[model samples]
Target: MFFKPYMRSLAVAASLAVLAGCSSTGGTQDGSMDGTGAAGGVGTGTAGSGQVSGTGMGGNGAGQMASTGIPDVRTIYFDYDSDTIRSEFESVVNAHASYLAGNPNARVILQGHTDERGTREYNLALGERRAGAVQRYLSLRGVSPSQVEVVSYGEERPAVRGSNEDSFAQNRRVVFAY
Candidate 1:
């Protein structure tokens, strides 16, 4: 009877030792569990300071407002072979409107480009169409025509240099310069 009780105690001790070993192994894998590691296992998550760390957006995790000092102006993209301003560009138009409204003296140059697939003259026309489309939008947004200048580079300057869709898409664009 005494041997049975002693054996039971030894078994219990062995089980505890095994558990301790497993726990130490886990600790080695992830030290943050012990609270002594950097970030305290929170892993740089959103802390009340409006700073989101380790979220992979780059910068010092100072949140959206800090990442972009001034709210980014939305870029308006155009469809292939068309200069018509799409509905998606409405926000960009509005943002530009607000900026121009606030800064009356600010002047913008609209530069348009086209993919390399078209003849130079045809691409020039297309580029002009693209710039004109943006000018029209800006005019509609209450910016005076004098404050904006439109120029088309056609196939002369491509934003990207490849026959692929990605490069073509990038090449067909209107850029705003202030």
Candidate 2:
């Protein structure tokens, strides 16, 4: 009986932690989703060459697959339904942030995306949050706010087409277009 109360308290704390982990900064309390008029394209490419091919957000047709001096790790991926950046991508992002800091004229577009599972609105919001997380990380590392542009394609543009976990893993990512 002595340990029962402590176990109960522990259980409550764990439940709260799980709830907090699943909370998102997207959508209204009424379940209505809002869209941001951000612009960007979708696609994936070889990391070594740093080439991305896709239509520009507004039909610019400027998207091409070529290494334009971008770093090898241009894409930062996130886990399922979470906007937090994974630990493995931290150094890569930091490298990009450092490069941005060194070159004020260098501009990058952070295209946020998500897998096809959640509601369109939720995915979009999650994408935005993921991109925002990277933006905040860059800012923390001394990158200027003006140097980065954020856009969320959500589930509309996927890197891979499939319902399997592999495709979903590839789909959930933030690509840096320079």
Candidate 3:
């Protein structure tokens, strides 16, 4: 009886732990499936049928790619279904801002993306929001508005392919194309 009670206690503890972990964040493990816009409908559903090219910006098109090449910082990853830029990408965006400040004529393109989870339309809007977040970050840092343009490819193009969290994380990102 003692051993039986102990086992029961252990099982309950384990179950509680599992539930707690999942509840820390809102929505299901698959954000897009929750139907709550908290995740912005960007979830890693599966490989999308639309296989558009995913050429994230690495350098500005005006020979910047050939001249300056790509800096060490090129890609910024975001949380599932979120357009808020993470603090980790602050340095990269600041560097881009500094570069733009120095090169008045240089232009940059911000390409936003989302994992294949939500509806295509939702993902497209989410992608645009992500790009706009980056644009705002750069603009706040003294980068000229004329130097920036934003595009949203949505989930049509993925940096990585898969429905799993790891792949989804890779696909949810903004490319800093100069």
lDDT of each: 0.50, 0.57, 0.58
Output the TM-score of candidate 1: 0.58
Worst 10 residues of 1 by lDDT: 25-34
Indicate which candidate wins on lDDT.
3
Off by over 4 Å in 1: 1-71
Best by TM-score, which number?
3
TM-score of each: 0.58, 0.62, 0.63
lDDT of 2 at 65: 22
RMSD of 1: 26.2
Tell me how candidate 3 scores on lDDT. 0.58
- Candidate 2 lDDT over residue span 71-103, tens digit each: 666886655444544434555676787678878
Overall local distance difference test of candidate 1? 0.50
In model 2, the number of clashes is 0
Cα lDDT tens digits for candidate 1, 1-178: 0011112222222222212222221211111221233443432111112211221212221112322232254344444444544333444555665576557787888888776764688678767767776676667667888888888888798765777545655666677767
